[model samples]
Target chain A: MGAHTMEPASSSWVTLLGDSDRRGGTTAARNTAPKELLWKVTLGDSIRSSPVLAAGVVLVTCRDGHLYAFDARTGRERWSYATPASVHSTPSLSGDLVLFGCDDGAVYAVDRTSGGLRWKAQSEGAIWTSPSVHRGTAYFGTHGGVFNAVDILSGRTQWSRRFDGRIHSSAYATDDRVYFGCSDGCVYALASSTGADAWRYQTGEGVTASPAVKDGLVLVGSEDHVFYALDAGSGAVRWRFQTGLGLASSPAVTAGKVFFGGKDGHVYALAVADGREIWKSPSIRQITAAPLAGASLVCVQGFFGTTQAYDLNTGDTLWTASLGGSLGSTPVITDDTVYLATYPGVIYALR
Target chain B: MNRRTFVYNAALGTLHVGLLGTQLRAFQNTPSAPTLQIDIQAPDLPLSKLAMPGLFPGRVVQASHAGSLLNGRVQQAPVGQMLDQGMRALTGESTSKEAWAKFIEPSDIVALKVNPSGTPTTTTSIPLMREVIRALNAVGVPNRNIIVFDRNSNQMEVLGYHNLLPVGVRVVGLDGDWAIGGRTRPGYDPNVFAEMNCFGERETRSYMGSVVSEASKIINLPCLKEHNASGVTGCLKNLAYGCFNNVARTHRFPKTYTDPAIAVLCTAPPLRAKAVLHIMDGIRAVYHGGPFAWNPDFVWEAKTLLIGTDPVAVDRIELEMVEQKRRDVGAPSLWDRNPQNLGSAADMDRSAQKNRFYREPGHIKTASELGLGRWELEQIELRKLQIS
Candidate 1:
């Protein structure tokens, strides 16, 4: 059975980059990469969509056009929902539904438990980013340059706005604004209620990376090799930190520090308020996905097979282990365990 | 003049009589002025302030890294190093960033036209692309202004161009000027097009991609591959075929219009003025089965990066390297026109020594004659570097 609850009665991850503690808190303070492999399963294709966990089930999307559910403890396949094209969008759980966008230009809601299709709302172009569900609505962007806000219950489009570029960046919603990156090289703050452009800050390049909002500031990375912190209300750049390469991964904030990875092959931690460099790990190859920031440690996957975890405070390498295949997705941390997916379609459960 | 089979074939027959050499010589017989009916029309747009053969005219840099490829996979460090060295040498600048500033500006929307149709076997190396993006960033070009694009979005996605580059830099694949067959699509500019009637096709115009048309400058990143239609697929050919829509019609089986079309396309406004740099990726190249590395045996790691503002000059050097590789492999050169030497049309991989068309490797020379860049090998100052 599926349930729609944040920080449920136990430690679980409800969304991409979502996690809870043993106290049933919403903070994904996962501090370490577990040493032992619990179970590992290979999907039909590469796992670009990060895994979301709830109710002892691990949900992951694959380029094979399927949303697969596996027993978290056993790594045994429970069910899988197939789509016409690949699913690059990570799954967002709403009640009993698992919602995501697909390469076929449609957003589908599948029953989380049975992996059966609930409803499909179509867009004119391919959807490469995940749906951000807030206030009973799902928000996402499409290659057609249209960002759609659909009702979570009925999978019906409530409103849409067309931009000059595709919305490859997923949405991060605040109380009033939904922040997302656009191909036109701008980070937009759209009104959550009306889908109107509240304010936009242009970056040097497209903003494919999602915004991570905290304390009135929205943090996102641009292909311009710089990470920016913008004011949530006015979209003004408060501070910007240049990286060695372009940023693809979203920032993870914990204890006033933000951690993110760059295409330049380093894991970086900077002050969230001023965008000053606190510490940066040595070059480790290109990191494409967001690092899983727990309370004490932040974990990132190299484009290659190795996954490394560093201390959130000192940026010291805490642990390094191979996750079997080249990692194209982010590391997902749940209470007591860590999940890493690879481009070759392998999913590893380490505890 | 629209290049016709009668004129192209007759000229080749006459040229072949005196040219007991490679196919590049075939282009020499092709006069600078066309005898065929061909028309090139660019939109009434502002010409690029920075045009081809920029900074150093007739100069080319060959940067080779011994560790550019590891077990056939692209090595990032060596690729990045090679780019830095190549850019520094090409611009005679002390740093790569300073060199990039010679052509690219902070406000300019630079299009990095990539060759990605070949997919996994060979395309623009991802590592080199990253370095180019980084270099552009170093010069203060916003990631939004630096576009990594190809004609086919499908091929670009398959090659991981979107994932390979940093976020914020636009990785766009327009699919083509035409979405389905030869029909016009929004991705193509209705204003700018190359008009030529080939094979009696009703649609004679191939539009310049809307993405490239919108950009202020272009940096060509083409792969070192042979084309079944055009013998030498280099910088000019990449821009000619990669940016224009409905280009496949230029070559039907054994016939081709790539020679005049490619050279003339480069001479057209907008493209001629916007395209300022050419970097040919020869790190992993296809000596045969070009356009695509259809055969693994034909793909080799040349570990070379050809950089220059003169597309024609860089392409000429690339062709010679491919020719030399063909010689080493005991395979017929791309210029070999002996139909008897061609493998079965059904399967070229079976007989690795195969000729798809009397490949117009001479397109490089034709482009040179069209005033694109230096075509004569003796005129080009090639600076070769073996990166330790």
Candidate 2:
């Protein structure tokens, strides 16, 4: 691993940035719904990957067999790098390098500022999960059921461990451990230093949902429809909540409330302690987007053109809007702006 | 109007067969007892000239045949001649179904289960799809009553299917709005899908599918291709694509009845066994990435169309072509690399690596064993029509 420093830069509130992750639309930050469509740029093919904003540049991966960088506000083509196959993984920014996995079974690191290529590490299967960085260690899962830990700067492999199935879930990083789940029905905690297994807990079915850790407790959901809270250090199950269906959406923890969506067409808020139910709201359709929480608002997106914001405490509706298409992307909230993506190849910015 | 009149004449003949007692012998000769094993013995006459026997009598009759010319072992002919022979071999009746159904009313709906997921180059051709629609229309099957469906939206769009079909002949996809509306309430299993089997055990799952069940007659238009997991995807593959929520789950246990499960799921009493006619599109064969073509090189242009009511027989024949291609390419058979034979669950063998093409599709054999159709090539009447 090498010493790394990510430049601190800001993106203007005027333009929309990022890849068409999940769905195509991105929410804009404004008092009124996005009116001024920034510059729209066309690539070679449809983009299924999400875009991440860092250092004033938007890093996007496209099915057109390229990883692209553009000015966040201007949508001007900055630079582009071609790959062997599709890049479905959303690029994660770590310092000056952007890390992403491609369908060609390789993890690539590119210069975030210059859009220049850095280093590439190969995997057995395609990498659809975004690489999560922590303490100079980068972690991500692959289609071949392997979780790899690589040095972010040099792209050297630290260690690799195999599971029973594919790993579509992205990695979550804390201080010493990188936690994630796989299609093999197991959630694993590995030491970020050497990729050695710290702990593993099996679920009923596959665990494609990502994990979110806070304060020594790791919260994650599984395809088995069970939401689990594990001991951050030992990977022991602290509490598990059984939903009516498989849980694909990652859990978002705020205060004492854990918000997530179940495939049974319901968005649930559960007490993080002992896995008790708090309040449940029936989404009009299956909720694929992870829930985003602000001060008093819980924003949820559904697969069938619906997005709603509810009062965090009482489950009261704050606002509801039809996006005119299915939305699979998680909404990112920044002050007053909420950004999301839809399937019809358009991103919407809602204020 | 002439074709409609011919259908009317055929319907009158069918009525006469129903009324007369002499037709019982023709029905007795229909060969209802399903043949199990494959016999290599050649039939007495050439299959092309032979009139293929029918399974059901009064209701079903032969429609016109359709075929495409190939470079080797086949010749090219006019479109009308090629389509007529192919349609004749497909329907097996001398006249259209509308003519034979004058005494009995014609069906209101016809579902065409198309293979949009096959390799792009070898997928069902637009001409073939158009001919099927045209022939059905000649039999008085209205355009509004016809529907062509597939598993994926992108695949259907790639094959240029949306533009080929007439406006009345709706083309539907799995992810499309109309198909999504067909989704029912969540079954016993809480998976994202609408249906489920029993808990804790994996067996043949029984669930309601509006598209599969509601069709008056199903015309399965599947592309013949090599499948990495299921051995070969053909008419039987349609069952998997048409019924299940997530097909990737079927690969959990290797060689575990994926092919047979699809066949059983469709052939079992209520789900589909009633009204299905398979039209295997061999226009372009995907010798390899299959189910989805990632590599364009693996595709080959084998212009042929295979029609059969029995899915097992159709797939067995198709699988034979895949095996021959692999053999010609000097590669291993699907059996040699079958992943199911890997390290046992009881013994974790560190050296165990998954065989890429692991496991022969047991479904066809199992389907044959269940008394569906003949597995051997000898029993099938291979009608090699010279389209040119």
Candidate 3:
């Protein structure tokens, strides 16, 4: 089979934590509060993967070890394929193939249209990071400290690197480099083509948050309670902001503003240039997942199971909806719908 | 008669419940009736077999000190002394140090699996944990090697356990990140798990905590309490549910009993092999409204500590003690769910009436069936001592 290389439409979210850049920043505008409810579907178990919309289908993985595809508008079950173990890794769409890793230590490529297995490549440990597919190569890391670059079409390893600790951070791929965080408390930048180490920035604690690279700054958070921005080329620290506790939330950069949630339960908006706090919201419970920055509103899913939307420019609270269960997955923002998943296996499509 | 009626009759000490033929036959050969005979022979059996006498065989030591608790706090000195006497009695060793040496060594990394759930009054007392640490230290296990842990980090933090323990004694909460992600943190070892399809749950496997897999030995420290779902939660439930992740999926709506699940978990190779000691804190026992401590009226100064290697045997004794306490308070039996007695103090003061599920105290016997330990009253030799 030939590799499908259709560019995602500007409005589609085709990868985990938004696009392959892992920016989680969207430009699609939508009403903050819609009067009507869309549709909701229950899955087999809790979901930790953010939903990705590709070609009118919403794709999400469940703790029950299944990847489910639902009709985006109607919430009808399209198809589901089960893996050997639970999947926390969000799926990346590459043409007609869906690529994701599983806790069973295998990276799978499934046909998007028929839900059939295309190819599977085994890894040494459980994969918690979503695959970042760039130029027909899938890049991801596993808990076993193995970072792999697999060919998307044939499911063959191009190159693999070993680290000292687990990797939970998904890779953010640019034209030349891929950036990710590791449990060994380091943010690593590697060449996209050869899987060679480009630069490594050490943090005080483990780095589980995926890197958000905008302009020339690489922004990531560490469990050491510090949010760091480093020079993308030199790996030198540009600025660091300390919070009350550690941070596992990835930053969402949009419109010259960087938005991130902290383990201390506060959401902070900072200037992308100098890392100055623009606004800090009150404690909304521990924010572990990345904040979704849409055109006019910034939506954050708190670990306490509430999804709240704030004014993107003012950081003012716009609307909040309780999912009634813990949420580890990031929220998906479309032009008309915001898809959120809760730990109790319920997926809510709110417009 | 229905199974419920038979259980009610059995709880009332009626002899006419013909439905209990198996139990009647099992009890007929017991010469001491309620008093258990000591059986020390360790049986060789498969993992599926339920008749292993290897877990402390037939002995259980219960040491009671009247002044162990004062002003709702456990006196460390008296509890330590009581622990010493109980260990001596349980192991047949003359001194506490000698008895402790039988179970632990200097080079071993010991994990003290403490139950930190429920209210302050019903949770494992910090004083008792100190005593356990002291005993471990006396046996030459270093402070760094001693880990005091519970399932939830937040609950342990809420109970002030992190600050209460000794400086070098590492306190860990296994599921610290559960609230954040719903998935248990990396603290659970994925390699070691108990897989069983109970009640058709989606997550059929319960992974053992990393502490259990890493430690050379585990000392199960459970508090004495009446669990609304499990009837009574003592040694078996503590090590079973406490040491494993994803156990809440076992007993959900429509069916709330953790019978086979608890037994399967406790008998899992990782726990069944590593867990060598069972020390149940009964100083403040809750006859009702527990696992969580909300109703003070149902709580009392039990002033007792049950120590044994046989979790099932210890749990069986705890079950009888809780049943007696429930009877003394005019509460319905754990098995007989009479909704008519809903507003009583023993029924979680009626606040937890709707939340309460069908109780499954028979998990102790189920563990015994799985060859985890002895559960029958006739098979257990209980040594009751007063350490004043």
Candidate 4:
């Protein structure tokens, strides 16, 4: 694990919403839009998990209970692994293994190079959130509100803690603390080592959106139509911006700008400093997925089957594409390509 | 125009001009004096012989204050004062302390059953709930002994009741977090249930929550709204469905209305004996598309609270208020069976017309048949109060 951690940082997108920091690989020098469409592939079922690129291969999980690997450049199918139930969780890469949870109540670790199963661990309830690999441990939560920490190499549980509500949001981890939201209307920060409670901030409603931690604040949204910015160390509310409807879209913070979408059919951009609205683009219909910030662009998927890209700084419409099917999955952007999937099983790769 | 002619013209879609003229005339006239007493005596049974013995003897108090709401939000001070007046008027006590003491005791484990359904616009007001809690505290019930509960924890959290209530007051949800394939804890008492089959639903038995079983007494807090299945979700439906699980099966299809199901559930032993008071929040009433206030246009300011020990009697009066509001809004009667009034699948697909259910407003009368309380308006003793 230490040897792998010492490896030079590659420009690979290998996890749900891009890495444990959840910045979607945002960087100042890499901020430029992709040029045009590269390729497209049609699959068997809807894809709710965003595609993850690692080792020249793209890994995606579909509602048909199959995990597929395709060549990142040529769009050629490499292999596919079948599971017992549907997969809604995106794959997170830890060394040579790809980890993800399934609705069948099991977490699977497959070989990243070949789509072969390494080991599987059963959970008490449906595992809907994607797993985050930190150090040698894989952390995930279940619909039964139980958060589990497991050894990534052996597929053995290390420890688990149960809360009072469902855990629909994925866990975001730093070196010391882990942050996640629960259906019980609380955002909890726990010790990454022992899963002990660090602190918890109560919100006005259930929080299905995952938290994005940057600087000294943790940002998340709730079903009560409020977006909260909390002090990361003490769990104190710094500021809040209320929308017309509840927000299920996890926020993407890049260049001090926060981008998310609301069920009220609006996409919003806000300043991270004071939670003030920078600009809002309305009339997009419901957006249930997280926004992706990369390549100087902010992209959001609408539940009504459209994906819109806006300029990261100006909130202007960069481009729009109608996939002709409902979309609830976040898009993945590489150095020169954008990969998105529709609920009707179509994956589009645009450059 | 007279009432009969007006209703007939409304059904024919020709009452717009007449309704506007009537509204103008009503606005021109001085407000009528409040009626001190409305005597409604049931011929079959005497007031002393009722299902809930010694509970108002079929009497209910309707207390209203125009100042109850300001800027669409409940005024906390006015709500507290309004509750005090309503409690005194309902129990005929001279002081609020004396009135609250009549039903609550220091040793009692009092549970406040709240309805948190519907849109955020029309749930039980937090101000009203805080006032209820204050009254309970005034009567000597400890904060720890008072429990505020609903069926769905997700909905309860959305309302932030835990943060809104005083410290030590416990909030519980019967269904836990995720309802689908979620494990049922001891929160529900499997020993007690309301058994019935509606449309061959597999989960025929509705289990009662353990909170209701353990409570010494319950204060039912329900909102005023039009229900898609039971016509009006008032005191009876709130207790009947809110306290039990697997109740969604009671009204699956339009034809299988929640008539006897609601009455049966309310009359179950776990709920019938423990629930002692009914407080209906009418500050923001939904005349249609309710039980879920999805549309804001259907909501109106009622600025009133109905308090009583007799659930049936209170609901009977509540039904009238909702029907009257519907009439004022030019919507058809709750009992209308016309295809246009009942709505079709296409209409249900639309947002504005989704409230059109083959409504079972007769559930109130069905509960009356089960000896719950008085259903007929004529058999109720209503005392109307205008709070300053």
Best by DockQ: 4
Task: Tell me which of candidates 2 and 3 scores higher on DockQ.
Answer: 3
Candidate 3 Cα errors over 4 Å, as ranges: A1-10, B1-274, B277-388
* Residue lDDT tens for model 4, B98-153: 99888778898988999988635577877788798888888889877888888865
All candidates' lDDT scores? Answer: 0.75, 0.57, 0.74, 0.74
Q: Find the 10 residues in a row with the least total lDDT in model 4 chain B.
A: B34-43
Measured with C-alpha atoms, the lDDT of residue A125 in candidate 3 is 65
Candidate 3 positional error at A193, Å: 2.8
Arrange candidates by lDDT, descending: 1, 3, 4, 2
Q: Residue A107 lDDT in model 1?
A: 96
Stretches of candidate 1 above 4 Å error? A1-10, A19-33, A324-328, B1-220, B223-313, B316-376, B379-388
Error of 4 at B10 (Å): 28
lDDT of 1 by residue, A1-351 (tens): 137354453346666666211111234455555778899998776677788788889888987788899998899999988887667888878788988898778999998878888899998566878788887888888876888989888988999988876677888875677889986778998888889889988886667777788778888898667899899888888889988666777777778888888866788988877888989998765676778776678787776578887877898888888765343466666666777788778899988
RMSD of each: 13.5, 22.9, 11.6, 12.6
User: Against the true structure, what is each candidate's TM-score?
Assistant: 0.57, 0.50, 0.59, 0.59
How far does residue A9 in candidate 4 sit from its true spot (Å)?
A: 9.2
Q: What are the TM values for chain B, all candidates?
A: 0.87, 0.67, 0.81, 0.82
Least accurate stretch of 10 residues (summed lDDT) in model 2 chain B? B1-10
